[model samples]
Target: PRPTQQTQTFIPNTSGGNLPEITSELLNSYIHSSQWHFIKQLAPKITPSLITSALLDLHKNPDLAFQFINHLGFRRIRDIKTRCIAIAVISGLSTSKPTLQLLKETLNSGIATIQVVFNELAVARDELRIRSSTVFDFLLRVCCELKRDDDAFKCFYMMKEKGFVPKIESCNDMLSMFVKLNRPYKAWVLYAEMFRMRIKSSVCTFNIMINLLCKEGKLQKAKDFLGFMESLGIKPNIVTYNTIVHGYCLSGRIEGARLVLNAMKSRGVQPDSYTYGSFVSGMCKEGRLEEASRMLEQMKENGLVPTAVTYNTLIDGYCNKGNLEMAFSFRDEMVKQGIMPTASTYNLLIHELLMERKMVEADDMLKEMGEKGIVPDSITYNILINGYCRCGNAKKAFSLHDEMIHKGMLPDIVMFNALIDGHCTNGNIERAFSLLKEMDRMKVHPDEVTYNTLMHGRCRQGKVEEARRLLDQMKRRGIKPDHISFNPTRLTYNALIQGLCKNQEGDLAEELLREMVSKGITPDDNTYFSLIEGIASVDKAAESSNS
Candidate 1:
């Protein structure tokens, strides 16, 4: 009674309490707040778990939910699990009726964490008994948006476990996921399941599976699947025929592909740009350049515009044939059509120029790549390095190699092999050996080409002992040597044989020659000449000694 009354300070219960009823006004306030901690702290205060009800309410006011998520403060709540669940429910409710704008926003707001929200929904499905088809459909779309096959499969199975029969659209979405994931086996299994469920497979479904099988090089299987579809009274659509034709073309069955093309016309199915593109690509592969060009012109006659891929195929084919002029003409034509050349376009041209020893032009193209904002990839540098090496410019090649390394690009085995071959051919055997050791240190396993190039160089320099040792080393490493490893010019063999014979080891040379013959290698005239000369010299020495 004598002590002064102590004043009690009020501390807000932000950590754990019954959250307030989330009304439109309260939701708006939280969305407009610049500080997410306020929302995060206040979110837990909303009572009776307002997630479902709030989501339903926001479906009527869709813009409010999006606004809340778009706010910087709301993004901070993204890290909180409960807040994330709340947002996922809101997203699921709006998924079916999503505006293009909302889909874009959802994708931009971290797809991975959005997936976690879907997982949480799946886990709590039994407890919540949430049978919102909208939620399931939305999750399927999220999977498509994120291209998450495994997660999408999990969502699909969860939907089934909840006694929700997936519609044909959902099934198609799952099939697409499988295709994107490169799982044709899983895709076919799902397709069969679709048929078992009596859900009519759409033309899109057939197209996806056929394209998937074709891409995997299962042409016969793809064709058989198409035939099976036809047997079921499912007339093959234009896409169905296109996919089969493309598959045939890719498998190098151009004639079969053409037959399919003809059949497409006979069946009153019009071939699209894709069909023509496949035909052109196949023709180009067969070295039928004229036929490929004719197909391109025929595509225009059919009123289908040639895409960049179409032009790239022709350009690549010409480049492969070492016809840079024709490739450039196609490139110019592509530009005239307002189709810009991509990095691949320049890469192909640069590669071709390098193949022709046009280093000066290749270097200019590299500069052009930088100017056009096209960053050179590993292959780009590799082409330039190989070109310089082929032109006997080892110094420039090594400089590029060092530059590539400096730029954090690891030199692949191909690049290393090119350098080694260049040094060896330039009479720098020691340098070549050094590169071989370097390859070992770098864990780049040398292939037959690497060893062969080094061995041939040593033989050329009359270092037969070293060459023979290399051959033995190759055998020890369990690397099978090719014919080039054993076969060289007559001078190389003669030099080695003469050395052996001079050292009274003619028997070994004779044995080697016999072994060569047994291996089906016909000794050249120089080989015979070397052996006869060596024997005659030996006889002369023997006669002089007798006298």
Candidate 2:
């Protein structure tokens, strides 16, 4: 017979629970025989306090305690103390999966702050007399997985403060998160902390640091880091070689990338698809298309299949160079090689078609995309929207915009800019302003092109004051005119000056020309022409008024 249910010996953790009491012995008996259905019958009688007491009684038997917790259900075990004790029991098992999972749930539940959870975990760990740091490590692992860097850092240093050195894997997890978050300085700080704590670094750790260095444009430092890892007896894997190769290629140093490639090959590390892909991308960027094609062939000879990205790189290069015939040929070759075209592939081809003003061909490509069941992503829609806008088809462009939204795709700033430019081109300045307002409502911050388009539109409508105000608003929003692409900026200024001059504001036009020059933007011939024409007209007006 089961042990008799005891009288209420423990108070509830919360006011709502008036749970019937079952002693640990009875709970333990029901759990021992795998009679979970019997224990579950007492669920209406169960509270966090009862569960914690039962867990403490079964601390020596973590498996049964875990089973009991699972039977009662984690959702019922809502309190922090109960969850923490449950986690501590699970941590006693050889595998950390259940422990990590429970900790992740606890953290994600948002019922308790990370600090409260950590505090409870520490207390539970000490009460259970478990000497392993597995629970803390799991906590950090969960934090890293959640991308909660600050919480992970708190848990890490908290463990260190309590004289518990986290394992290398935990440190690496946090380090990897910091790198992914693009917080390089924080990553380096954590690395230095790891060094100070004498936690041995792993290949994964060194790889993350190398990636960080490459992202920071310290390619040489990244290479030297490889030698540093070797000194520490950690061998470089294929990922290590690929990282440096990618960095070199991205920096336009083909010879440097080739040196790394040869070094990897000498070390018996055969180049993979990514290794060759970098070279293909580099060669394409340098306009060596034929060589890139040959490299793709070389990749196939080495039993490596090139990805759609590799082919897309070549197609984009050809498209940029106005070689549509070759671009289409490569697209056909990819299909022949059994590599189906991705939405990106169709996007590239359709974009090029539109760039060549072959609207019919572009539409045909879009139809092919649908036939292949390749759904158009945001880039595809942006391409088509911009294309139709350029062709003075605002009605069609707007129709596509509605279709995009109906398809659950949010219009990006590029789409908005294209629409604004189209409205401006069609002399629909009021509609352009409406779009700008819509951008504000959607919280899409306008870039320089956005403001530039509006400013030009205002100038075109002879609203010179409003145009000047937009430039001021742009400055106030901290969006500077793009100095790299000075032509558009120079055009904006010329339009504004011409508008001012037409309003017989020659002095303001000259002042703006001086401002343009002072900003190191040379006044082009159109700039000088606007000023000259303005001054001549103003002089003629003054003489006519005197007559």
Candidate 3:
């Protein structure tokens, strides 16, 4: 009878109706209410638990919770705990205190929070300052985040003052901070302190010190540190070798850098991207384009993808070698790899083109740069103006000059020299002098090149006395005269000699020639020929008068 009457069970819809309209004030009043039982009961059902978790979770999902916290008027929590929790959460997630501190300081100042935590921790432990390695490690991280070298050293000092022994890892962190900040002197002091304290240093510690030495251009010292590391049974990592290699490159010791690369391979320390990049840059700087290209291929064969910097280095190398076609090809290849060329890339290309006297191409490239939203910098305009001046295109050069001034880009000494040189070369000596006067008026102190060009221009017009006066002015301005500064020209000497012969002053010219010879400058064949001809003519006239 029960089987014949099958009963149907009804499921009630629980989620379809509108949720109870709970205003934020009501929810907050319920959260901080005095009634313990009611507050606990309402918290779970309302927003207290959610808000607390949300506050803590801000560290995990900062972007999502940022607007919510801003709207909720938790400026103090947003400022302090939000950053601390975020860093602590990320530190727990990545297990890298440095990276956590880096991200935390990038987003907010973790300095004050760390100081507060340190003070609280010390008081709780009944110590003058942090004594635990863990606590010191945390403080070291905050120092790194703030990039406060003095504060970092103070933390180390406080650790020692408090009779707390620092761990090797803590010492390494301090050393790394000093190295990164370019305070190798402080790093060395810390290293010696570590040795005195009998705190063992790790491979990372040696690596950081060696890298610091390399950055200071102390390659020989870096090599010695490498030996010390090896003697201590600390094997060098790729980074250690890379730092040495880069140091060698910087010192223009490409051969030494190569030796380090070979040694790294021999030691089974495989070369990484940094290793290859440094090698390539060294080769390029030495004008070994083919070697650099081969290195790029080798890097790719080693399964190391070339980054934008890698490609940019090669592009610069090609540009420097005056191979614009190959440079552009590399640029296209970089674009194919979805890499954008930076302003440096364009500047290098423009410089190369200008050096090759390809003004039209340079102008066109400048226009293309504008269309690409790349504004030309002062160097770019300088290159073009210099090229135009070299080609005797003064109008175009001056037009660019005015345009630069209009754009608020002041002309440096090199630009002024180029324009003055163009005037001298074009035989516009008067105009060149006018520009010199303008340069003085503009408070642009004349450099050696400026004086040299003006002196040479005056000598060319047979204004040797005027040239000498300018030379005196140059001395007054503290500009030293080199051999080139003396206005070298055959016509200038010829005119002076002729004037001396006309005035029966051949003896003076001969004396001047003797002085020149004493100065290690031989008179040209033209000078000798002019002297012989003048003497012979004078003697012939004397013989004729006597006859």
What stretches of model 1 exceed 4 Å from their correct place? 1-37, 41-88, 96-129, 133-158, 180-182, 216-238, 262-270, 319-332, 335-377, 437-443, 459-547
For 272-369, candidate 2 gives per-residue lDDT tens digits of 99999999999999988898899999999999998889999999999999999999998998999899999989998899888889999998999999
Runs of candidate 3 exceeding 4 Å displacement = 1-187, 202-204, 215-224, 227-236, 249-270, 319-322, 427-445, 479-547
Per-residue alpha-carbon lDDT of model 3 for 1-547, expressed as tens digits? 0022212221222333444544445544443342334323332233333344443434444443433433333322323323333333333333454434433443353435445544433443332221334555566666765677777777777777767777787778778878777787888898888888888888888888888888888898999999998999988998899999998987779889988999999999999999888888888888888888899889989998777787888888888777888999888887776777776777778778878888788788888888888888888778888988887788899899889989998888799999998888889988888887877777676676787777667766766567757756755665344322333334444545554554445686686567556656667877787678768878988899999
Show model 2 residue runs off by greater than 4 Å: 1-20, 35-41, 110-116, 458-490, 503-522, 538-547
Window of ten residues with lowest summed lDDT in model 2: 1-10
Structure candidate 1, residue pairs in collision? 19-45, 19-46, 19-47, 20-45, 20-46
Weakest lDDT window of 10 consecutive positions for candidate 1: 1-10
lDDT, candidate 3, equals: 0.68
Order by TM-score, highest first? 2, 1, 3
Return the TM-score for candidate 1, rounded to 2 decimals. 0.68
Overlapping backbone residue pairs in candidate 2 total 0
**What lDDT is reached at residue 244 by model 3?**
96
Estimate candidate 2's alpha-carbon lDDT, on a 0 to 1 scale. 0.86
Better of 1 and 3 by TM-score: 1
User: TM-score of predicted model 3?
Assistant: 0.61
